[model samples]
Target: MDMQMARIGLFFDGQAELQRWSHQENIFERFIIEVLEHARVPYQMIDDISKFNTVDLLIVGLASENHLIKEALLEYAASGGIVISYGGLELLSQELGCKILPPLEAGYLVLPAEFGQEDPLRYLKANPWQYIDSESVKQTGELSGDDQKSAALLQIPVGKGYVDRWAINIPETIVGLQQGTSPVTEDGIPAPDGTANLDEGILKADDGFELDWEKDRKTTETGMPYFFTPYADLWREVLLGHLTRRALDKGLTLPVLEYWPAGVQHMAMISFDSDMNINEAAEATLQVLKQEDVQTTWCIIAPGFSKEIYEKAKVDGHELALHYNALEAEDGVWSEEAFLEQLEWLKGAADETNFTSNKNHYTRFEGWGELFQWCEKNGIQADQTRGPSKKGNVGFLFGTCQPYFPISLADEQNRFYDVMEIGFLTQDMNHPSLADTTIIQPFLEKAKRVDGVAHFLFHQHHIYHLPKVKEALIEVVRKARAAGFTFWTSKQINDWERARRTLTVSANGRLEVLGAAELPDVKVWIPLADADAEERGLTYKYGLPGKTQVLQVQLNKVEL
Candidate 1:
């Protein structure tokens, strides 16, 4: 019953197109890397076949069409290693026991709920894939469509392992969507009235790109104008399924509880945006926090008369973050002089020389890259302005529940923003249609289910003036505590993410920390799945001030 860690290997052929694309924009590999890190899965980018011997799972991209690589992958699968192929790598279709049919020239691919209810892919049923072809194989999963049912995803069991083949070019599809490339019909023209018919219960955008409206509504609605799906969620689901299956097959447990510090299942950050009545609102919020013994962030508008309240909150161990309002600009475009003036005013008003976090007023910014540059230059370590509210909705705008650095799609070099973006998943004003606070529970549930950060933004004025608002805030704290969520400020969340960036775990049970930041006490949890595998050094806890830390845990060896 010994357990073996899963070693994931990604094969890259160094193709010129891939290299160019990597240089220009975010690619599938980047997403894969992020998902793997979040899941604490050890992986390596493999360009040479020599490394195949150490890999338990092999991931091949479309660019990997070399004959030698194909032979290596087939052998690996034959020897009981999982192999997941994306786009290309067509040479092994027959060997993998699946047939790669002609390219499916459809506008979009729909993933019905019936097929993925128990799978991790259930989170992606709301979103549809744009521009997908068809694959012919024994459908191991459910397939739903109007015309002849086709396999969008195929799982074929080969010797002792399996092969997962995706019909869509996922990386290219992501790039096209990011670049605003429109989805077109099979005739190479935009679909009439910006939509095309796939089958029953399927509607796709005429343009090759996903339309915002499609995601705002349900696919089964009248006319089925929209195909609601979360793009990032879909990718994560694909990875999670493969990783989980491999772990189970290897007599190991998937690390499902390692997202937050101290092995906490989830995290919550509460911030009160002081838009009006700063003095009274601040006092009320402070009293509430003191009563609950919780520390939260207070974002006050610059040049406002809230200096005394800000100082009081700081004295109470609450975070005083800048709420940039005076320098609001259109299209995220800002004037340097005006921006600097706002920053200076906030510093003087709060009587603080430096600030670590910010959230723009109304969450408005000219451009993410420009805002990030300004924040970095101004010594702002974190920004929580990026959320799903841009379209005036309450959901993950970036399709991510965790904090991450924003990448500029417009920048030809595809540079990473120097600042951390703690995306706001929910705010008080997000759902104007709701009369009460029922929306909070659903958002919290989603965050906890994914072991993601639940960053909530509430207005101080609302708590003071609106009864329902105060009730909602109370309910949030109660439910979050009941669910074992660690409440953190923006600064704390930023610091944790920064530390995790340099943390690494190897398949051999080596935990390495290369970051220099001072981190809070955290516990790493590794579940014991096998009866014969006794938990040996499965959990480790570390406290502050360590520049670098490494721990070695003894894991039982398992035979494949």
Candidate 2:
């Protein structure tokens, strides 16, 4: 079976129950579906377990009280099929060779499963899980618990197959996050003063900012969507590990770590928001870029800045993109008409006809989906504004450091917004709370450890006004270079990500390119572990305008 189209079934209780449970929005199902879709794993909801034989894997919700469904699942597992159960493990505990124990009073928290280095869920930790008791099963891996003694997740081997029992309520966590409430918060009340230590400094979000608790909460209590923010790569790893294991069990090969370019580990993109002191700041920032031989994206507010400075930055190999001024908008709400008016005015003032990148001032927007749609409709190809604006606080607003097309929360399946979103890791203005300039190094290291993009933003005014800010920016660039990060402007990163989304890999080491005919020439990198085609002298440089390109390799000899 093609992993890209791997057939998986999601068994739910019913449409009405799902709607009522998810608050009539399908948020829970959508969250799971989004994860599956991102992994290129095709899935569909099934009302009957009789169709289990047709799928490679079965993910069933625990809320189903039907005995027929329970019996069907047992039969499927016994017949050598993989089953992952969420919520309702009591119905299958006996079949799984375990006894259900009394639930914990304080519930459970998600932690790394003790499966050593081979565990797929090893990297993901600290999410909330529902409490449950279970007798230890043979060959089981403990994945979650409140303390080291409890078990929230258990992998039970039955016959030729296995069942992953997720006792925690993942859907509830997702639903609570979508509602802008933390699942683990005590009665939904935030800490006194709404300030909490994140990384090294106290992040203050209590001053009536929307999503304030989200920024203040340092741990998984921030809830899903955002809770998954720093761990999107880990989520992908868990999903890919499951799929890869199933494929290997069937004597097949699968590509690994193909999302990043050439598997260089982590990447960094430097950008400067042109706030004030346009001429002096731009000149100073340009000097630093030239000295470091680094190219970056410059977001310019075009009302009063000199066209000569913009042209000079463009000539110096820096990207000049639009910075939508939120203060200019009426009541900080951006309509398509008002947005376009400012975009055109800015473009004309800067003497640029086309712009492919943008970052909104103050990171303000009416709706994330709306902003993405407007950018797509207006010809902006990429954006980097979907993060918190305050300093001393750094976390994923979208739960990913990888570039992805923003999904519409209102219309879950609408895919028309083709613009790419490159997440912001940190900004220079927010670094003062740390002990020294070196605190930013860990942020970059975390991104690298997960093979993510560590895009950093600095205001030109800050660079000119604060000596320590300039020193910090310089240190960041130097450290990123030493860490083997290939620095790219926002436009370059966006273009590369667009090309990557079109790539397809097979278990047998066949590489194919699709839907990239209109894109520019791009250098595709397959990691050495998956570099069987390159070992056989396959072409790595691809010039597009072709719908498909195929390369074959020997998968059996490829090492993990």
Candidate 3:
């Protein structure tokens, strides 16, 4: 027997002026929705509190000082509806027999061992915690600061339901960690004195690398710049787990749609940047890919291999994309015109009209959100530049192994860019230090833990000139394949992710496959919430022990 799925309602106060929820202030809303979608948790957005009685779980993003919202929340909880809220403690302090205290700027949240978290959670930039003191409030976690009285995680019972509140603003901290604390300025990090071969100032990818070395960076024996602790991903998991537990508490099994198709444990993608664009060099990498029986993405440069070679690659099922060069080549320049020119040249060279993915030459990036905007302007669906370029900066430096749509702090009404960012783990794994399994295995394992894509970048030029690089490429392919990882082109990953976003599960266990054409092989795991599910011939898998048994269903079978 299947239990009715939990209905989640995200309450967004519509009176923007009252709460200052302008485009600038709406990053919280944008990021929270992104997190829910990425986690495959379906939610309905409600602006009015009248609908609060409908959803089983209500996520209050910001209650601000609205007394009406507070009153409605109290009534909903009294009527037995779970609430997860952030901020707005002052209005409810007196009602709940609590006192509000001063908020902290940047702090660490020491999650209790009950949550199975070891390291203290770090919020790079915070939006002021809603410090509260109440004897009735059960503190699951506390702030690791001078103020031992303050609680980081609070669970307060109202009438029948409970309200779980977090002192810190999760959205702001996650946005800051993922896309730098501040906007990327041209003068953010000065280029080396003689490295400026051009008269004009050009921004590179390094200028935008956001992880703080002092607090966030993790060092390894390999001596590579590997941020072992995925701070952003970890915080994301905490929120998801807390939500799942709350659903379970309400006797509902929260269904999470797995990231990869057909419940694949993990997936990997290998992309080769055509630096020299030599026919022989490109063919060399293709030969290795063919041996592994994998289809990979090729980021091609201008004047790429002969048309016949590209045709052969196309026939062999490889994605041909642009390798935007803004480095030292003659066609290289850091201007929109130059970007379009190079993109057009590569498209023509590959005998294609539009390419779905691209990577900047040298991982060249300048400024914030400009490249993403460019990707949107073109037909490009995904980007592969947000990774380590040098040997030192190799694994999880940018703090994620998943493909995500970058949020533009500048955009009004829409903060998220359409183009997806498929960040690679390491580029050119030929260096002796990074080439070792000791360095690579951790990233691969972490991606599996998070159900993220482990992207690896190898250059065509290196594969041809360096025998070590070729050997390393083969080694990674075989190892990842043996580890139950399937290789996909960037286009396939982007297409699948976008299509699955439309998938929805009804309260009656009916799966809605909106993009069935694009999701032929997709699978969904719907939990069997009945106590006697196994006795009725159902199976239990996923989640903790004694959790609900889930049955995997083919997505295409139930078309919306």
Model 1, 178-283: lDDT tens digits are 2223222222223334443222221112212333443343322123222233444445555565466556567654443255665455799898777774578778
Q: By descending TM-score, how would the candidates be arranged?
A: 3, 1, 2
Question: Given candidate 3, what's the lDDT at residue 412?
Answer: 44
Taken over the whole model, the C-alpha lDDT of each candidate is 0.56, 0.56, 0.70
Minimum summed lDDT over a 10-residue window in model 2 is located at 540-549
Q: Which ten residues in a row have the lowest lDDT in candidate 3?
A: 190-199
User: What are the TM-scores, per candidate, against the unseen true structure?
Assistant: 0.71, 0.70, 0.87
Name the better of 1 and 2 by lDDT: 1
Worst 10 residues of 1 by lDDT: 540-549
C-alpha positional error of residue 260 in candidate 2 after TM-score superposition, expressed in Å: 2.6
Best by lDDT: 3
Better of 2 and 3 by TM-score: 3
lDDT of 3 by residue, 1-560 (tens): 34567889988676742345354544454577888888778789888889999899998865656788889988998889988865544566666665566666666777866454567777653222332455666776766553545676678888998777777667656666666666555533422332212223545565555554455555456544455656677777777777767887888866666677665658899998877778888788778778878888988877678898788788899998888888854557777888888888887766689899989987777766778888889888899987765554567666677778877653344368898888888867765434444556777777776778888888888888888878878878888888888889999999988877777644455543334344444545454433463464443323322332233433465455
Question: How many backbone clashes are present in model 3?
Answer: 2
lDDT per residue, candidate 2, 1-560, as tens digits?
Answer: 23233456777656535554455243343345545544444357877666888866778753355678778887777787778764455666655556555454322233444211221232212222323333434323344343545355566666777676655444333322222222111112233433322222222111112233433234322221111234345444444455545544544433432344443446788888887746887788788788888889988764546878778788888998888765533243357776788789877887878999988876654533667778988999998876655432445433457676654543443233677777676577324532234445666766765567888788887787777888878888889888888888999888766655544334333443334234433222332213343245442211101122223322233222
> Which is the better candidate, 1 or 3, if ranked by TM-score?
3
**Which parts of model 2 have CA positions greater than 4 angstroms off?**
1-23, 31-51, 60-75, 85-150, 156-160, 168-229, 246-252, 263-265, 302-304, 328-332, 365-368, 395-399, 410-417, 429-436, 509-560
